[model samples]
Target: MKPMQSPLQHTQGGTSSGHRAWSALIGPIGLAMAVGVAYFLGARLSLALLTKPDGVAVFWPAAGIASGTLIALGPRARLPVVLGVVAATIVANILGDRNFAAGVVFALCNAGEALLVAGLIQRTFGREFRLESLRSVVG
Candidate 1:
């Protein structure tokens, strides 16, 4: 008689377990990489077009990108989102001709800013937050 397998079990045997694990990892990895790339590009664009003689940007859209990503992903995905923000911020600052120390500091500050914004929004409106109402946006 053939061995009976649970419905939850994969029919592909040993290799399928590894494949499943790898695929699970791929989702987070891909999200991180996409966020990193987006952050880097946004920062670069803002620095190029909006930076002044004092090295401050008139508008920094990267912050919005990071904060929006954090809020969209929620607390469960905070690790990967922050990681991507940190990596991208560091690289963007370095490529923008800042020193290594400055890059690291800027990266930390940017990530912290994103976290703070996301935290405040979550606290105010809960996890299922939507900016559909005026109170949600202003308050």
Candidate 2:
């Protein structure tokens, strides 16, 4: 004879059905802000690090690597983080130059780099770090 799982226990394995609607709206909304901030900060940090050198203008790509790795490995919010960051970078470029060409390049290259890194992480790590795993380990 097996014991029946309580409703709470059964629902705890994944996101709850009731919260699915809330997640639909809030998840992307929150990720956008986080990605924007991460991208901005990542780019700014790279720019500052490379400011002393001349003829080295790969700041956006380098920042993408850092930001992407952090987003993909540091959290499970890789896609949203990268998207938000790329969008913000494009917007910043357009604002600065009033042209979309450079922005497009930056967005595409950064996103590509991020995707590559994310794929590599997924392959290397076997699986993403999960909240339940952490909880079990901690408890």
Candidate 3:
């Protein structure tokens, strides 16, 4: 015989669900560093080709990477993703010879945008989100 899960438990993925254990198992630093390195590489690659006259990429893939990192890792990853995004953004811009102040500002903007998009996805699709509905695409 097996114990029954509550309807809410079956529908929602949160602390009592499987995802939290990964965060606990990996610990905070590991997650941050992994996301940071991935973001940094992604930013660097995009900058190499997409940079405009002002040193800004025409399309910043790092923002998508950060947002996807947060959404996939769930709510627990927001801080690490933010740190990764900001650090990666500033470093990539600096390496490309952008002004320090501009890099700082750009980093903040990139982080903010990723956070906002991730929040919207979390709201629309829940923590364990899926691409199951038109709302996910249209919204």
- Candidate 1 least-lDDT 10 residues: 5-14
Model 1 segments more than 4 A misplaced? 1-20
Residue 93's lDDT within candidate 1 is 84
Give the TM-scores of the predictions, in the order they appear.
Answer: 0.82, 0.58, 0.73
lDDT of each: 0.81, 0.59, 0.75
Cα lDDT of model 3 by residue, 1-139, tens digit: 5464422122244356465555454555676677788888988888887655665566667777888877877766787778877887888889977888988998899889989999988887777687777877676
lDDT of 2: 0.59
Answer with 2 or 3, whichever has the higher TM-score.
3
Q: Model 2: runs farther than 4 Å from truth?
A: 1-18, 45-55, 58-78, 95-98, 128-139
What ordering of candidates by lDDT runs from best to worst?
Answer: 1, 3, 2
What is the lDDT, from 0 to 100, of the residue 98 in candidate 3? 87
Error of 1 at 125 (Å): 0.6
Q: Which ten contiguous residues of candidate 3 have the minimum total lDDT?
A: 5-14
- Per-residue lDDT over 1-139 for candidate 1, one digit per residue giving the tens place of the 0 to 100 score: 5585422234465557776676657666777788889999999997787546687877778889889988877885677778888999899888888988998998899999999999999998999988899998886
